[model samples]
Target: MHMTAQDSRGSRASTIFIVDDDSGTQQLLADTLSYKGYATRCLSSGRLALTAAAEDPPDLILLDVMMPDMDGFEVCRLLKMDQATRFIPVVMVTSFNEKAMRLKGIAAGADDFISKPIDATEILLRTRNLLLVKQYNDFLKEHAGILEQQVRLRTEELEKVIAELRTTHQQLVQQEKMATIGQLTAGIAHEINNPIGFIASNVTSLGKYCERFLTFIKAQQTTLAACLPDPDQAERLQAMGNQLKLERIIDDVPNIIRETMEGVDRLKSIVMDLKCFSRVNDAEQSIADINQCLESTLNIAGNELKYKTIVKREYGELPPFSCHPQQLNQVFMNLLVNAAHAIDTKGEITVRSWSSNGWIHVSISDTGCGISEQHLSRIFEPFFTTKEPGRGTGLGLSISNEIVRNHGGRIEVESLVGQGSTFTVSIPMKSQGHG
Candidate 1:
């Protein structure tokens, strides 16, 4: 029961457990530690100390070496084995000065050993130093937990930002590509329109000239037959006419001119469709017919669709809606092309449009292989594609979705794995501020 040093240093009142069989020794240690601003609990047996420590672990344990039921070494070993109490420092109190005794205490996981007739200075110093180390360790663990949480949060935020940036980049690239294509097509349409116009006009004139010449030749032959009554002269004129196949020329010339004129008219229609599909005023807003946009897109994408699928139009009466024509054309184009590609061999792509409840709906349905449930949700996600490499960039639907959204519209899709897919685009009739 040695109590000599004054450890009245810290403001914090830390709890310490003092275990000893001797009542005098327990009271002496508790009083000394309590005076030093440590809340002390006195347990008279090793079993009582372990039970108390498990219920409410103290910062440190002062275990006596020589006890009845269990000694300090066994008590220390038990405390160290418990997960909750293992980190608590154990200072063994004994009168033994043998080196083997210290080694046994150390093997039992004791932090330090105090000899009998303990110096108060030594006990206080060792206790204060162990408590400080424990406090520092706890602080570090708390700081590490906070740091890990912060890192997790920051990583999530960065991932979200990176995803957004990738989407934006894909959109920008698509927009630039569409813009260049529009400009090039518009220029080509302008260049070709001039020649087509003149060719069409010239063919029309040529047809009329052929009709006049045929009429004049027939009238001259009839006049010659009536005026020259000699059989030899009339027979010679008939022989010349039969040799030249005059009747065949008169019948075939009109048919040939008509077919040529029809071909020229077809060329003009294609050029007009090209111009409409790639209009130079892409950013301009107008009250446009959605059906007309679909028709123009169909004509422009005919070569892509013709080889694989047949297009069926089921257009209902739709009111003119205010929107960007070129953008809508692009949306229809993407849907049509995708529909064509969905077909493995031959299939039908049905395009339907109708207006109801103040909304204009255009649906492109394919009889081709449909999307799977697993992939349907991610079809509009940027860079998500099921097409083979180099066959697609996977941004078509995503960009089209954005374009439709800007025009106060949405796209809905329905599909079965083996059946087919239908994509419906709905736009408000009174959409505002879309370019």
Candidate 2:
């Protein structure tokens, strides 16, 4: 029975190896597979076929089950055991159609079977279908590998983006610190200038007083040298002393020195307070009195509030708590500044502190333009601001919130429009402090 199978694409894109003891069967498979656009190689024995397959694997194998010397079943097992040739499809050709023979062939790794009176159509169909399945499997594996590579690349890119974002956030925090320092520098410069200016003026006055005293001493020496003093000499000496105001100079020098010393002390206190507030690098926590810190911050920020707000303190008794003193000072400064800004004109800002239930609560209340409920919820969000542009950076409350939370604490607020707002900062007696 001579039949020609259709070559689907009319190209030898697939190779089929035929192993048979029968020359007729080998020639038939060759012609049939070649006509179906499959390239074919023929071997008379299973040994030749096994050797050829190991040297160069084929896409499919058609083996006669009852071959001499080495049977097709043995050949199939050998091919299946080899890693390189195992994926190739194998079809068994045998006259025996018994169920036992079929099971035996299947166990030997045969993909399909054809009878002795082989139907050309059956052979072509089985081979074509198996080739299609193998092709599809290969394609899927290739696609999966590409997908895995792409996933790896995307993960790396995401990690890089996260790193950049973290760096930018840190930079913003540092910029805010510098901006706060800038504001403090302006106020402190003015504050320090006041006492220094007056002290310089007092030094000038003291210099004039010293010169006048020297003149009085020289006149007194001249009068002493002439023991038989004339009335006119005595009168001249009294006049000179009166003109010099010697008695008044002697009395005022001590008072002037005292006042100058007081001014110097004031300058020192201001400097010390500023140093405490700006201990940015001293991130270590220590036992500190929040009340004392609040008072010092109040004094440091006094220049900003003095003109527009009257700050009143209602301090309550409190024990020292563990905290980063410098950071808390910054929070106090920010709160006071915000309170002052809320007031358009003169107003009262009262700061109160107390210790209760293993925590310390510090409250800053202002009688000014209060925050609306709509904006209050977003107040702690970074870069959120209600103040006019250029007047605020909107980082104060956000930073304060982070600091408080880090210190094992929290902040609360109460407000009424056009009435006032109160910000209460609460901290545990002992913090999980950071360095």
Candidate 3:
């Protein structure tokens, strides 16, 4: 068997290995290689060389063409076949100078060839070149592994970002639908109120006529009672009283008028709320109570959430901040309605406001199905929606975001899927003064 190559102190060196059947030739090559700062090993036969390489392969191998038991061709073939030893470069060393024999060694997987009576310098040069090639190969393998790992990490990060964008898009779509509904509320209220107003007025007039007619009949009854001592008129008076039915008319007229009035009042309040929530005026900046705006918006949306959800308000003390009241009203309205709709069955929407650090913060939270982590980053993007087609237009939050930004404020959101979502809006309480 080929002995393991060692340095002067018996530690393995960065290598040059030699294999030959002739002991003298193997020793010569090993000594020459060792003198040139290369670690060297020598083996007596092809079988022994193959065995040694399988145990502890060198960086480069020099195999003799002619050997006992197995030829150099066979040894080279075996080395190339084994994955552990395949990378070691093999240079066939031979005494025969035939072209065919050299070609045979090459075909058997020898990386290079050196004809013997080998020159010391030639052996060293060939070994040095082969070692450089091996070093370069190792570097490439390591670099490839690192590149693959980086690509995998980057891909994961990108996937997470994409998921967040999708979610944000969905939220913005819902907000847009709410905003559109807010804009149309005023017209809708006006259309319903006109008919309600006249109907209530007519009911009031009819009630008064009924009361007068009943009073006239009661006066006739008092006259009949005064003349009751005369039995002749008693039967005629009773027949007249029963035909008029004055008591029944008096009892039923008031209830009809009251019910009509109540319906009209309810319709009128809805119209007032619609006007407050619509923000139809075009003003750049105005001072207004944000809490009042929230209340109006909730009132306008009452019909929307009446059967679907409940709204809870936790309004804190807020200093009046300079803002476009109309635009801000739109923002609050969109957020409130969106929160209500997020619930699939029954849910609660919470609106809270507070002031701190020279800013006013409004938080709208929902107890419905919440947003997922992947979609949180994209909630304000234009045309994003989680709602079905015809139910959403996806531009509400995007527009709200733009309006808030114009007023020097920012909107942020936090959500957990299957739990709930919260949106926080922060706006500067006072505009920056010009120098």
| Cα lDDT computed for each candidate against the true fold | 0.85, 0.81, 0.78
Estimated TM-score for each candidate: 0.55, 0.39, 0.47
TM-score of 1: 0.55
Residue 267 C-alpha lDDT in model 2: 65
**Best-fitting candidate, measured by lDDT?**
1
How should the candidates be ordered by lDDT, best one leading? 1, 2, 3
Instruction: Output the better candidate (2/3) by TM-score.
Output: 3
lDDT of 3: 0.78
Location of the lowest summed lDDT over 10 successive residues in candidate 3: 1-10
How many collisions per candidate? 0, 1, 8
Residues 197-275 of candidate 1: C-alpha lDDT, one tens digit per residue: 9988998899999889988988998898889969799998889889999889889998998888887876776565556
Residue lDDT tens for model 3, 1-435: 112333223455677668887888988898888786677777888887878888887888898988868999999998999999998899999889899998898888889888889889888778777777777776677789999999999999999999999888975875686577666765776787788778878878887887788788678878877878977688776777569874675687788778778767766765654554444334566678889988988888888787878788999999876788877887887787778778888999989999898999999999888887766766776557788864554656765776676667889988888888998988888744210
Return the TM-score for candidate 2, rounded to 2 decimals: 0.39
Question: Model 2: clashing residue pairs?
Answer: 7-36
Alpha-carbon lDDT of model 2: 0.81
Could you give the C-alpha RMSD of every candidate to the true structure, in order shown? 9.1, 18.9, 9.8
